[model samples]
Target: MSAFLAPIHSWLFNKVLLFQDIEMDLRNKYLEIYGEEAREIIEETKNYGELIDRTKSIEELIDLSNIHGWLQNKIQNGESRVAVILSIFIDKYGSDALKTAEDIFYNNGIKQGQMAKEKENPQNAKDIFSTLNNYILEGMPCDRVQKLIQADEHIVRWINTSCVHRGNFERANADINLFYKLRFLYLKGFVSSANEEYKFFETNNEDDYIYNIEKA
Candidate 1:
């Protein structure tokens, strides 16, 4: 690997492993709750983790936007029982599961931000926003954020109209409040890691947000 790309490759590999760990944790939790039924669903869902592990290039990882579709098809059409079993798991364990993933992503972002600062190349708004967005994508299967070029360059606005996380929550009948809380935690983590003063807002639509990077 080239010198400039080694760290990124390492990071991606570690992320794949982290994804697997989270999957295993969720599988165990589901097994504890639902026994054999959960096992079958987990077995069927193992491909999700395998796809991450088999991703050999960053571009391949970035192209993994179809995860939500795969999940939906699996749950809705693969087996009738899977929908109920998976819903139960999500309703009961979704918050905790998502929080765990967020913590992993957040800590990694903090470490990367610190590294950049120590190198005397403090990240800018674009860089920070990109990193935050990437962390979200890494932690979950979702569409990429749509960056808007606002008149104020210091602020970054983005829209995510299709959130697989939200879809999952809705499908599982999970509390929407928990999804909001997770979003807050993710944004807060990004701000702290970037070490920037900023104002953030989530829209009533629940899928859009703005980040004012350089707060006066």
Candidate 2:
């Protein structure tokens, strides 16, 4: 945190920015539907933290002396905002709002997948899995939110060692399962768009969810 930003710092920062971007998209849609009523929740979200200036590099905006804490705060702030916005809309609009949120996640995932393909040209399930991690904001790299269960030419399997979104969603009175479902839409979109041969899936595993990327 001393003006010595590593690749991981910028990586985490980018994921946070992506998360915020989705929040902004939700805000815009809220305004379109609820108009003035959306103002209250929109302002409430701003109270969490100032949005990051995405055009600028993380190096220019992050707190040099508290890099880890700063990135962690971004994740918390973005997740809380997302949870609040989606929860309110879900309460008001029910399945309709959920549909819009799903579309946002899925379409954004496709864009990210396409971008990752351009950069990495991922040729296998494991490659797609790695690229998915690059875009997913799971926690700090040290937190190790994901654990690889297996990997080979045909597939890659993993489980969540920890969840960084549950607390935020719970505090906002949102369903954590819904959040995971939406994220899976994003991942499904990502894998398909990243490589037509790859597909993504998730299933219940007692307390933790198991995720897979495999040949279609």
- Per-candidate Cα lDDT values, in order, are 0.46, 0.85
Model 2 is weakest, by summed lDDT over 10 consecutive residues, at 1-10
Q: Which candidate comes out best when scored by lDDT?
A: 2
RMSD of each: 8.2, 1.6
Model 1 regions lying over 4 Å from their true place: 1-122, 138-145, 149-153, 168-177, 196-216
| TM-score of every candidate relative to the true structure | 0.46, 0.94
Supply candidate 1's per-residue lDDT for 167.
49
* Candidate 1 residue pairs in clash (backbone atoms < 3 Å): none
Q: Write the per-residue lDDT of candidate 2 for residues 46-71, one digit (tens) a residue.
A: 75777888788887898888888988
lDDT of 1 at 73: 45
| Poorest stretch of ten by lDDT in candidate 1 | 74-83
Candidate 2 TM-score, C-alpha based = 0.94
